[model samples]
Target: MNKPQIRAHGLLDLLRLVAAWLFYSSTIFFHGSYLSPLLVHGYPEAGSLAIYGYMGVNLFFLISGFVIAWSAEGRNWTEFAAARFARLYPGFLVCMTASFVVQTLAANPTLPYDPSTWAANLFIVAPAFNRPFVDGVYWSIVLEIVFYGWVAIALFFGVFSRWKLQLGAAWLLMSVLNESVVHSTALQMVFITQYAPYFAGGIIAQHIVAKGSSTEALLLLAAAFLLSCKEVTAGADWMQAHFGFSPPLSSLLAANVIVYALFGGALLLRRRIAPTPLVLVLGGLTYPLYLLHQKIGTLWLNALSPAVGRWVALAIVLTALLSASFVISFFIEKPIRKPLISLLLPRLNMMASKLRLDRPA
Candidate 1:
């Protein structure tokens, strides 16, 4: 099979910016009101519009499915594991620590700042330690890690590439049953039942690109898209129950359609979008921006809004966070990732060899 022609383009970065700024920063952060009680909250019309921004998380999962599949191709489980660790851990450490310090200094009652919580968050599964995430957005990172673990396991068993379609179909079926019928929290959490469609769609997308589309692939993609539209509404239901507001069902479905369209457009236009330095920089900063944005930005808003007025305060917070993101991406992650990978990969490979799983790169 031909290697997937996945290329680095700025489109996904642009989507990340939308997810960070438009969805989380502009809409849900303010709309949820759980995190930022101090901000102005009388604008129902605006809140209605902003509620759809939550679908950015869906967009992220879709992107991850494609990117992770591409990254896993032809690599053994250890290499894939090492690469994913190198990619995720350094940035997470820097950003999580930054969040810890900021939340500590701000002393915000809404954000956790306890040392135990901070220590637990260091592992990125704070809930297992009975501590909350320093930032609520870290929940999605955990899901991404779970997906990566499944991929690594699949690679280990030598079934990932060969059985992707069958696996995706089975996963989709399980997602449907778990979400709509069984309603099992354990399944939802362990299998990511609610969001499986997006990931499966992304993997199918990668498969289509690499192996060329088949009738079966197209049908599965369509099924995944339709299921995604159905599943994203689960977020709206939660928001409605908690916040007493959500985008109209029509709006939610339409937004999912639009997000899927954007993904398709990005794929179709990947060749047209050059991997320019500015583009790379924009994409590079996305992870840090996502990591550092929510809790820290809200604290900034709560602190600065009373003084500078809300709009001005938001601008200031965004500007500072963007600058911080750039610094972390360029100065911290770029510098640390390679050396960390170099130091870590061989150890992992040695362990793999000991386990008799090592293969030539």
Candidate 2:
């Protein structure tokens, strides 16, 4: 077997940091009044503006598509599965437990903090068990896991490399059909129809990086971009139904354009970005920050805002969350990841061998 083909780039790390900040400062603080009324009582206009920040989630999916493609290279399905589990589960376990503890202490009505809920959350499919996530932001994590599962299946079938474009095209078509005409909850859950375009765009981005651009790739990318733009508004519609207000359609469209531009720029400039330690740290902290920010920060704001002021409370909460994320990433997650992978991989490989899934079909 050859070494991995894809190289790490700091630009992607920088983008992850940007996405985390956008979600924290804009979506959680301003537009998320529906989740926590206290956070947005006096910031209606800001909420409108900040609602555009939800595009950060779309950015995440695009990055995931690219990174996961990069990761899947030069590895079998077992290795891929083990690597993903080691990468995600440690941070998820630590952060989810922390959030549950904070929620329990705060006793926030909006956030649940029971032992059963916490136990269900350990699987990242708490909703399937009829429990809420410790943090609402975890909904995206579930989608990511589903995407990973599909990628692993593709790898096992030996189709991911041979039929990449064909699969992507089919996915894009199904996405359009499901979102526009089918509107089936089961399809949305299974295929992730609404967000398929962004993921396809990311995968196409990685293909360009690896093989250089071609007519088919560029055309597929363009289709993905257009579909992404169209689907992004669905989020706004959801906000309107729930929160009674959402960012203007023009603002949403503008933000979508900017996101794609930024992603494209990052890919173009990746060689120059130099994967520095600071950049790696920023990227590493993003996951923990995303997991820990919303519910814990809201609970902190509920306490601190009463004693201090809202702005001060916001500053304090952001600083604390950043600090906690750093600690979790460097101290807890890093140390545990290698050992966890080492322990899991042999077992995973053994199971794969028994099932004859260690080799691609």
Top candidate on TM-score is: 2
Model 1 pairs whose backbones collide: none
Residue range 42-107, candidate 2, lDDT tens digits: 344464465576778888899889888877876778888988999999899999999999888878
Worst 10 residues of 1 by lDDT: 1-10
Report the C-alpha lDDT of model 1 over 138-189, residue by residue, as the tens digit: 9999999999999998898888999999989999999999999999989998
The global Cα lDDT (0 to 1) of model 2 is 0.82
State the weakest 10-residue window (summed lDDT) of model 2.
1-10
Cα displacement (angstroms), candidate 2, residue 307, comes to 1.5
RMSD of each: 2.6, 2.0
Report lDDT per candidate: 0.80, 0.82
Error of 1 at 275 (Å): 3.2
